[model samples]
Target: MTYDLLIIGGGINGCAIAREAALHGLKVLLVERDDLAAHTSSASTKLIHGGLRYLEFYDFKLVAEALRERERLVKAAPHIIWPMRFVLPHGNAVRPWWMVRLGLYLYDFLGGKMTLARSRGLRSSDAAYTAPLKGGHKGFVYSDAFVDDARLTVLNAMDAAANGADVLVGIAVESARREDGVWRATLSDWRTVEARAIVNAAGPWVHEMLGSLGVNAASNVRLVKGSHIVVPKLYEGDHAYILQQPDRRIVFAIPYQGGTEIGTTDVPVERPEDAQIDDGEIAYLCEAANRHFTKQIAPGDVTSTWSGVRPLYDDGASEAKEVTRDYVLELDTNGPALLSIFGGKITTARHLAEEALGKLAAPLGFRAHPVTRARVFPGGAITDFPTFLTQVRQTWPFLGEKRAERMARAYGSMLAEMLAGVQSEADLGSDLGGGLTELEARWLHDREWARSPDDALMRRSKVGLHLTPAEHDRFSQHWAALFG
Candidate 1:
């Protein structure tokens, strides 16, 4: 059977588009080469914020849209997405206080303020706040949001499937061509499907997708590699710090999964798939973090590291960080109507989807309804996160408070569904260490399309960062015995 839309990538953009289109009464098919969010999506810094730095590039429209979406995501998925206060400490070479304040003021007013707190200045004398830096450093606290990027992608795909979209994982597209009026696409996963229009939301491989279809538009993608390191928690509170480097790039030290998450360098890359965290990048990150905080973190302190390529739109910026974070969609109406997306932040994926579909509607001949604005995602059915926590406590009283809270944050209301048949912690079965249970593994494998141990540990859940080497080996053996 033919579908009205075929999404090439299973990253956040593709999944969001699939969910949006499916909800709008269109037949949709989404195919991914690897597991969902295995590439750039999962490797993100995992922030759902308006690009505060994008203001320097004069991308007020993009920042405004992203800021609004940030608040929307926080409300829509309270379990996974929440407000985060970012502390930006001023350095000698950084922007002036008046400029920073102006930017923050515009940011607060650009997007219609809702639940998130407004930006403010902090004094060094505030005893309630611990000064991680030397004296004479002022701070600017602003609003942002954090999300489990990998889980967000999966949940979007799951919502699309629930809404009647054919979600196909581990399926690679071999070829796609326009035939007469419809597009014929062949798959490598022992299946072939046809669609009227194709969305080349392949993230870093967007240009490659267009090349596969022999379509050439204005090529404007700059593959910049960004790397992150996960270490043990260094701070006690939920606030994250934005550290300024001497080179003018900023690094983030955020609280992640009860640990400290730090990242990101912007180096130009030749290929997207070749992105990896090299020794120099790690050292650079550590040096940047150490420059701002009293606690010095060495390479050994890094429990885990990941790298991703950002497909940024080249605007003739000499520095990678100066490149615009806004996304641009190029629509070719000649054959099969290819929609190629370039450079988008994770915070604005939903808005990108809406804008993309609006452009493709006339060509595809499908009237898609607008539902994503008010609709909640798969695990976002509830509004109050505390109420959900109370219900979960009542259901699984045997589970420890921390474990229950972790599961609820990760799986939301679906925690009950995931742990439905289990009565006690022992019933959850063998411990894979790092709070990972055998029952959770089976559920991820059976329901979440987890094929390998890395898929289970790194993407589906971040248990890999906490697992001991021997425990990880044992879990790999168990996974091989069951799947291989």
Candidate 2:
């Protein structure tokens, strides 16, 4: 099939671009080699945040761009993205107190309109907040946000598909060649698809993808592996902590899924798939938390670990940590115009998509209009979560408050569509372990392209976190039986 645009990679960037392109009246096709967000996009710190530390590297523009996108995401997907205060303890830190405060002030200012609270100082008397800290009498609190990163990516793909874009998962572009001013891409299964323009949003494999296309684009990807560990809950607050290590690298201890998630170690890697959390990275994360929190933890305390390679645009940075987090869009209009995306964060993906479309508009024969900027993702129509959740609970009393709230947050306005003609828990079909009903599982499969148990558990919904080993096995069996 011939498409106006063919996007490689189903990560946040690719999905966002697909949605944007489709919204602007383009026939777009997004193909991912693996499951949607099965890699780096899912492995993020799960925050829609401005890189506060990026200011140190004189990256004011990147921070401002990310902060603007951060605000947009919170408003656009309040279900998946919400503001969280980050506690940055002042004393016994790598950076000076003045510097930290100045940075926080700039962070609040850079983003323009503040939907969240500005930075403030926390006193020692605030025992509820200070009790968790091991040291440092004073601390500064600033706002960022938490997100279900995988779900965010999936929602973009969902919206793109809803807008008439073809989203094909588990399909790879094995080879591509310019044929009569169009990209003739061969899939892994030997099927061919043609597109007027091709977008290389392949994250870590940007260089490799270009190479496969036989395009001699500059290989500028610097693969930096960032690893995170999930451990037992460290503190009793809803707020998160950003601790400064002696090495000047900041690590986050976030309240996640009834546990604490501490990470990440920035280690330079040779390959894109080099996304394995090492022993040293785990220990470093544990130590980073133990140093600040009163409750000490070790490597043994880790319940889960995740890693992803950041495909930064190589600008001759000496260290991996020193690399720019900002995205670089390279447009090669020589033949069948190749738009290569080097580096980008989830927070700035929407804006990045807008920028990407702007570059491809003339070449791909489309008038680029910023439509997605005002639009929300699928199921993101509800702005007031609390009220929306209450309505969901009232509408489906059988779901109870907990389940209704979960549904409201996960599916938002689309909860009704999933629960249509259902009156009771019994009507939800089979109770797959951990509140994962047969109906919900089928919804994921039919609409979201969730083909396996892992896609349902890990990406579509986090119901797997509550499932027991035997229950997981049962779910797996049920999935195989239903799909196979």
- Candidate No. with top TM-score: 2
Give the RMSD in angstroms, all C-alphas superposed, for model 1: 1.8
Clash counts per candidate, in order, are 0, 0
lDDT of 1 by residue, 1-484 (tens): 7999999999999999999998888899999999999999998998998888888789889988998898789878888898888888775437777998898899889878578889888765654344666444576888898899999998898889888999878788888888878889889865677888999989889888888888886857999999999887776788898887788788999998778899888989999877899999999998988887777889899988889998998878898889888889989899677888888878999999999889888998876556798777767877798899988988898777977787888888788688878888899987776777888988888778788898999898878867788988998988887778
How do the predictions measure up, each by TM-score? 0.95, 0.98
Please report, as a residue range, the 10-residue window in candidate 1 with the lowest summed lDDT. Answer: 127-136
Candidate 1 C-alpha error for residue 179, in Å: 1.8
The 10 consecutive residues of candidate 2 with the worst lDDT sum are 123-132
Candidates' C-alpha lDDT:
0.85, 0.89
Steric clash pairs (candidate 2): none
lDDT of each residue in 392-467, candidate 2, tens digit only: 8788898876677777888988888999899888999887778888899899999999988999998888888777
